[model samples]
Structure formats: C-alpha cells, structure tokens
Target: MQQSSGWRGSADIWLQAAYENLIESGVDAVRIQPLAKQLKLSRTSFYWFFKDREELLSALLAQWREKNTGNLVKQAERYGESIIESVLNVFDCWLDQDLFDTHFEFAVRSWALQSNDVKAQISEADEIRLAALRSMFLRFGFEGEAADVRARTVYLTQIGYISMKSREDLAIRMKRIPEYVRIFTGKSPEQRDLLRFYARHNYTQEPYEK
Candidate 1:
C-alpha cells in the first residue's frame, strides 16, 4: 500500500492538475478521482501529495494569494521615477499574465460565490491589494483621502476587468494606458516614460487611435 502511494505522480503534478480543473471547470470539479483519471495515476498517488480534497483546495488558495496579491504588492513597491511611472508599474500586472493570472483569479472568485470561507479570503485579498495600492499612492505624496480614493479607483478598475472578462486589442489597450495613468495618478506620464513602458511590453510602433 505504501509503495503504491509512492509509485507515481508527485505532489506538484496533482496540485497542477487541481489548478487546471479548478480554472477550467470550477472548484467542485477539482476532485481526486477526476485528477487521478486525468493524470492517469492511481488514486493512491493523490494521497502521496495531499491528505484530502480540502487540503488541495487550500493549496490552490495559497497559490492564488501568493501569485496575484503578492505580485501586485511587489509591483506597487517597485522603484518608479514618478507617480505616473509607479501607476504604470501597477498597470503591468493587468497586461502580463506571468505577473497576474486573470483567468485563475476569475475562477477563484466564482468559486467564492459558493463558499463562505472562500468569500472571506476574497475580501481579505481585496483589502491587501487595496492597501498596497494606497501605500503606492502615499509614497508618491498623495495625501490621505486622495490616496485612498485613487487606490480604490485603480484596484477596482482592474478587478472590474477581471470579473467581467473584458477583452481589448493589445494596441488599443496600449494606446489608452497613458490616459489611464493620468486618470489614476492625476498626472500624465512623460513621453520617455511611455516609451519605456511600451518597450517593456514589446510594443514597438507608437500607439495610435483606430
């Protein structure tokens, strides 16, 4: 029995499979049998990694917190020449999948609708993200209420996009970024700063209205 449990897939593999299922079909679909069948491993292999389904779900939540909330805070804390640049740094999270997984976030949020515990975690994550953005504004000399409102504006807009599964052409989105920075930070980014931001996203040509 012990050898059977140890014979096959590793914990990461199971967890990854759980993540895929959770994102693709929601959390309820992230079961041991489905994952075992998907991985073509015996059910015993699942126990080698997780004690049960609840444990696996907890791991998924941890990963989400680490990747989504963690990256936003880090980006908000990244060195930027001005508030515009700092706002742009936060914008990178919206564009870059490696920095933030929108689909995964959406999935978890949907799961939250069905679970009180998940809903509480979602609220906690929201607070953490909002606090980070508030600090970013505060660091740039935005005073109290102004900082709070601006932070809410920035974070809520991104969350709205995620929740609604909004899509925009990359070029169109790039063209709007400067205006977004201005709106979010009350200052337009310099041409040089915009150029650097564009280059980071491999947007070579100058943005244009279409």
Candidate 2:
C-alpha cells in the first residue's frame, strides 16, 4: 500500500509537470523523458504509474476535465438561480490570465484533432459544462431553444476569447458579453452593467450595486 501511495504521488507530480509544460509550450512540447527529467525521476518511474505516453495523456485529459470543466459546472449549479452571477462566476474563474493561457487552449484543440479518445473526452466534458449553464439559464426564465442558444453563445464566446490570447482584444470582446446576455434574458442595461463589472473585476463590491 505504501508503494502504491508513492506511485500515486509520482504520477501526480508528473501530471502537474506535464500540465505546466503544456500551458507554457503547447502539447507537442510534452514528452516522457523531459517529464521524467523535470521530476528528477527515472523513466522507469513513469511506467510504474502509467502504461505509456498514451496513458499519461489520458490521465492529463481526465485531470483537465475534473479541474477546468467539472468544477466550473459545479459552481454554476451552486449559483444557478442568479443567471448573470452564475455566468460571471464561471468567467471570473477563467480570467486567471497567468494559468489559463493560449498554449493550454492550443493543447486541447490539437489533441482533439489528433486523438479520437481525446475528442470524445472533450465532447463529454463540454456537454456536462454546457448542460449546467443551460440549466442555469432556464432557471432564470429562458425557454427551450432560447436557453440552449444563449448557453452555447456564452460558451463559444469564452473559447474564442481564450484562443485570441490578447488581453486588449479580450477586454474589447468582453464589453459586449453583457449585451448578449441581456438579449437572452431581457435584463436592463443597468443590471447587465453590474454583472459585467463583477465579471471583469471579479468583485462583488458595494460600489458596483450603486
């Protein structure tokens, strides 16, 4: 059991190293020898935790789903009654300019094309996240096709912004997100402005409500 625990820890270290490297340099930059070197472990250590590079990639996809996709869905469900707040919260989570980089987006897109397994994983993760967002929109009074389209619009807008990777460009694009949301829910400009400010600044400060 102790040996199993040690192997699990090693696997986690490798996954973290791989994720960081992918975020920095793109998925093509990830390889087992380099990862082993980064972790200061023998290549044999990788075999203890994974069967091969494919297995490691699979694990990486699973981790991404758990942290990035799954957690955001959970957060949306928690705040589902307030559609604007829930959507903004998900955006705020993604606005970590340092961690969520273009390379990370590149990795996901590239892998989806190269690996059928990865494509399936990405599809499943997206469905779960989008369903959560759609449910939130429905709760806030959007109906059937309207809720679905709004949810997809918000989701795709976020992916498009991240793919662009320029803070200035994202800022310009983000300014219009509130208007889009309002179109779906009939929120007034003042209400949309409050949500927009909160999403951008990641704050719920008293000044925003006024």
Candidate 3:
C-alpha cells in the first residue's frame, strides 16, 4: 500500500493505536480500519508498516515481551546492598508503569484465553519471569525451594493485583511496602532502604504508619 499524499502512519503510531484498542476493549477491536479512522489516516497506510493485522498483533506481543518481561528481569538483576533492597528494586515495577505495564499485561493475558499460540507465549513469559525472580533469590543465598516459593509469592501477588484490577491509594501502598518486603524476603528493609525506595517514587512525605 502506498502512502496517502506522502503522509504515512509510522509503525509505532499504528502499533500504539492497536495497543490502546486491545487494552481498552480487547484484541478483536484492533482492526486496521478502526485504527485508520482513529488516526485519521488511510487504511492502506497500515500496510506501509505491517503486512497484515497478524503482523501488527505480533508486534504488539513483541513490544509487551520487551517492555514488561524484559524490564522485570532487569529489575530483578539490579544491584542492591541486600536482599531486601534487591526485592525493593524489583518493586519499582509495581510502582512505575514504565517498568511494567500491568494493564497491557492483563490485556495480553485475556487475549491468551482464546488463542493457543498466545497462551503458549504467555506461559513461556511466565516461566522466564519466574526464573529471573528465582535467580535473584538464589544470589542472596536462598535455598532452591525457598527461592522458588518466594519468587512465586512476589510475582503472583503482583499478577493478582493486575488480574483483579485492584486499586489502592499510592500512599497507603507505600506504607505497606516495608512489611511486604519483609514478608517476601524474610528480612525487614532498613530505614535507609525504605527512604531510598520512597525517594525513587517521589513519595516525599513519611511513608509509614505512626
């Protein structure tokens, strides 16, 4: 397909539109025509970037894998002074959407419910994420089963929050982080560690119950 009057939609633009549709409605709504209308571009413009809708959908999945899964693994591997701090590093994903897009993750998991190939991809992603979390625990001297269980505890709790679309006040969640870190790593985060975590999220006020 040729560009309309030399104005062609970029791949990122189209993919981002498709992503909005998927997260807002579902994957079925991510058609070329609707996206073209949404972008005020010609439907043929989509083809300039993608061969078909399947290619666009594949691109969405690839972006999800890179953004969500890739960032999660990187956070798990981030340097920290202790296991508690390490777990807090991974917690950045929960607070920051740029690190882990929970809504997109939920939408992809929902899409997987009806597509075997997508389901397989989601399963692979789960294992990869779990392995990274487990490795983080092992680096801190946790035993195999202990590391696996702790990793599951951390990962699944966040997934549950996404799946349930649970909403909480940000300050309240920040207050709970210290205990959550203790429960996940079997060690309470130091006052300095909590301060660092708070500063990272720009929670300027004190972040604990009196």
Writing each residue's lDDT as its tens digit, candidate 1 over 1-210 gives 122324577877888898999888998899999888899999977886778899889989999999999999999999987998888898899989999999999999999999999999999999999999999999989999999999999999989999999999999899889788878987767888888889899998775332
lDDT of 2 by residue, 62-92 (tens): 7776667766676677653466666656665
lDDT score for candidate 1 against the true structure: 0.89
What ranges in model 2 sit over 4 Å off?
1-9, 96-103, 169-184, 189-210
Q: Which is the leading candidate under TM-score?
A: 3
Two-way lDDT contest, 1 vs 2, winner: 1
Per-model TM values vs. the true structure = 0.95, 0.76, 0.95
Candidates' lDDT values, in order?
A: 0.89, 0.68, 0.92
Cα error of candidate 2 at position 173, Å:
7.6
Which has the greatest lDDT?
A: 3
